[model samples]
Target: MRSHLLNDTTAEQYRRSVTEGVERVAAKIAATERPFTGVTVDALAPRIDGIDLDQPLYDTTAVLDELEEVYFRDAIYFHHPRYLAHLNCPVVIPAVLGEAVLSAVNSSLDTWDQSAGGTLIERKLIDWTTARIGLGPAADGVFTSGGTQSNLQALLLAREEAKPGRDGLEGPASLARLRIFASEVSHFSVKKSAKLLGLGEDAVVSVPVDTDKRMQTLALARELERCVTAGLIPMAVVATAGTTDFGSIDPLPEIAELCERYGTWMHVDAAYGCGLLASVRHRDRIDGIERADSVTVDYHKSFFQPVSSSAVLVRDAATLRHATYHAEYLNPRRMVQERIPNQVDKSLQTTRRFDALKLWMTLRTMGADGIGRLFDEVCDLAAEGWRLLAADPRFDVVVEPSLSTLVFRCIPAAVTDPAEIDRANLYARKALFASGDAVVAGTKVGARQYLKFTLLNPETTTDDIAAVLDLIAGHAEQYLGESLDRAS
Candidate 1:
């Protein structure tokens, strides 16, 4: 038996390894800061092929070296200003250091025995997050992989709440003719969760969105009425705090009111936009988020944590008991008598990471205002981008700027056919990425294709956006045979 493995690695060893790793990663990040093009992939692949899988893996040094080469080298640099493709962004220093510490400790946060102090840390964070959402001190939640798992877990709770005394999710009566309400523009994760929860995809009712892309509250009421008339139990209404395609916020307070009136659970999937909680400028948009029965927020998206740090908060603490199970020896007698809330009682996973430390470190070091400023800065930059696009005859912004993301299409004057506009937007977005000048994504809004930019980095500026726009315009002029004067 290895003495190091038995006693756990020493603090000095951990410190030395982490410091070295951090420096290496930082240098790698700096070197690959620019938008990577085709040449590097071909150059790097040949070296990767030289690796022998049959070799015995022994030391952490070799493991870290390989990771630095393949994983870190190939990974997209979200910190790069030109990589404005998705919600992902550069992580903060505090959280990065916190991950180092947490990995050194190697705590399994599933149970009290496994986690110890880690259990307390995670619980406190959950309590703090619950309080932020207007949930009472009695409310509880567990960190999840991301918003999807959190959403799935929320639906699972709803299922259990709807069907009491059921052996499993079987029988027509046990299933409870259930239906969920969400905006037509809301994430498909809701539909996926519904199906996984045995409600079937048909059970997710797509409520209409107004011209602003917000879920129409009146339309939701009508849909709830229709479901009730059809003898279906209205399980829940999901409101998007920040929708995926367009960062549109559904009328959360209004949706909460309807949920209250109809006696249905309200689950807010604020995965992308929940970081606005830190921002005073945009917090009002998610006003009634506190009233939600459950809420999903991803620290990975907004808090600048690494991937897989997400949370699901429920308004009632006792509600978590719905997912509880007991394995005699593991959580037996005295352990259960101690009344410690085993994290496994609530989570979907058995060996969960100590993700709370990252957020805790971030909040502790940066203070609330620091993170809030990042959120505000991103939203402000997005609005600036929207304003730029609106003023320019070359582009058409889909909706008013809501959060960090803005969707717009490049419309040339001579192109009356919406088809041509869509084609131009698609080509322009692709052309910008392919040229390695700048990066932005594309999405469809009501049959029209539009370029999408989701800016999460506070360092990204209006100037950066303008450069991308110019590239987009140049792409249109080159490919679509449209002159600058013809750009609508």
Candidate 2:
């Protein structure tokens, strides 16, 4: 009689809480970024650890204060323009809001009852991505944790589809003799997926790359022929749309042709580059992606969404049936009669978050062209970086900027010894971090170490690159002189 469900929050209460929290975070982010001093974490660690951390453990306000402290102060703000490390970048406002809303609802997408509207929303998103990728109207796919899981799911299906008489074979042994072909520049996930699928990493044939870093189509064809002649089942061809090390896009049209000729499943891992589909200029780069048996796309990468928003898109909806398993309670015998395509049947996970909402909201708010333009802007910035380095004799740009990645080494004309040059570049990155000049990622290509920059933040400009270059050059001079002095 005394309002038994008072504890249950009303919609108005939920809305106000979300609105207040978002406004506060937005103001904090804006205010926090006001000072543009270029110092890295290594320089600030001593000062950062001096902050207080105790009192009012039971109070909600205190808890929120603590959350803000950890979130703002200690956290390496990826949204900061200087954060060019790895592939992490600034997520957009709309997507961030979507993340907040979804987190508040805490919807579990595992079953329809658990998330009725969310299930439909995610399905619609999958359908939209599928059609955009040129899969026929009947194609289907599901969200995964990231590109790694998407790659794994694609390969799992490939193994099942490729196995001779696998439709009836019930054991792992039946999947033997299955092989996959990918480029040396391909992400390590393919090798990991092979090992996890029981096919062994040896099963993934490493194809050679051309001067441009693209997977050699001719080499792939030869490997496929050899695989057939050897009587091994050609399971799948994993073509990379944007490789991790160089951001090189493989020749998809030629690869797709081979897949057709040899009847092998073609899975395109466009994890970093699939967003190019939105751009009029770069869309033609992935000309034959339409023919892929499956595709992997990371919304978190190019869509400006928060993490854990990745997908595996299959050419045919029926291929997902290969991963089907039935449970009585969740996917009941009686419910099967209703013909609700249980997403759980196609996924590798049982408990899934409503990740598609973030992407869905982003696309709805900005439209496909807006997202495409964002990709174009970043790619243009990368091209600008490439041009900047190409004109500078002090630097050695290893590869042409691909998509949003810039790979170059800080080797001035004064340095001759390869060993010493390598040492200079290594210390320069550390010095850059130590000095808080900029946050940059480094990788080795062949025999030399090169600093890499991934430009996913649309707000970043050529001026940012100029500042980082200035820092790198300054650090290089200091490091190189010390190396020479030490040797002398």
If scored against the real structure, what TM-score would every candidate get?
A: 0.91, 0.91
For residues 1-488, what per-residue lDDT tens digits would candidate 1 score against the true structure? 25245245565665666677777878887787566452355767877788888884576677788887777756667888778888897899999889877887789898898889899989988888888778876789999999999999998887777666334545854464888889998888998998787776588989999888999999999999998798777888999999998889998888888898888989999999888878866778788898899999998998788887999999987788777777775655466678975888888887899999999999999987788888888889988988999899988888887888988877777668787777777888776765666678888887888888999988889999998888887787565685444775
lDDT of 1: 0.83
Clashing residue pairs in candidate 1 (N, C-alpha, C atoms within 3 angstroms): 133-290, 393-488
RMSD per model, one decimal: 3.6, 3.5
Q: Per-residue lDDT for 294-372 in model 2, tens only? A: 9999989987789979999999888887777779888875666897756788899988989999998888899989889
How many residue pairs clash in each candidate at the backbone level?
A: 2, 3
Worst 10 residues of 2 by lDDT: 1-10
Give candidate 2 misplaced runs (Cα > 4 Å). Answer: 1-24, 34-56, 166-174
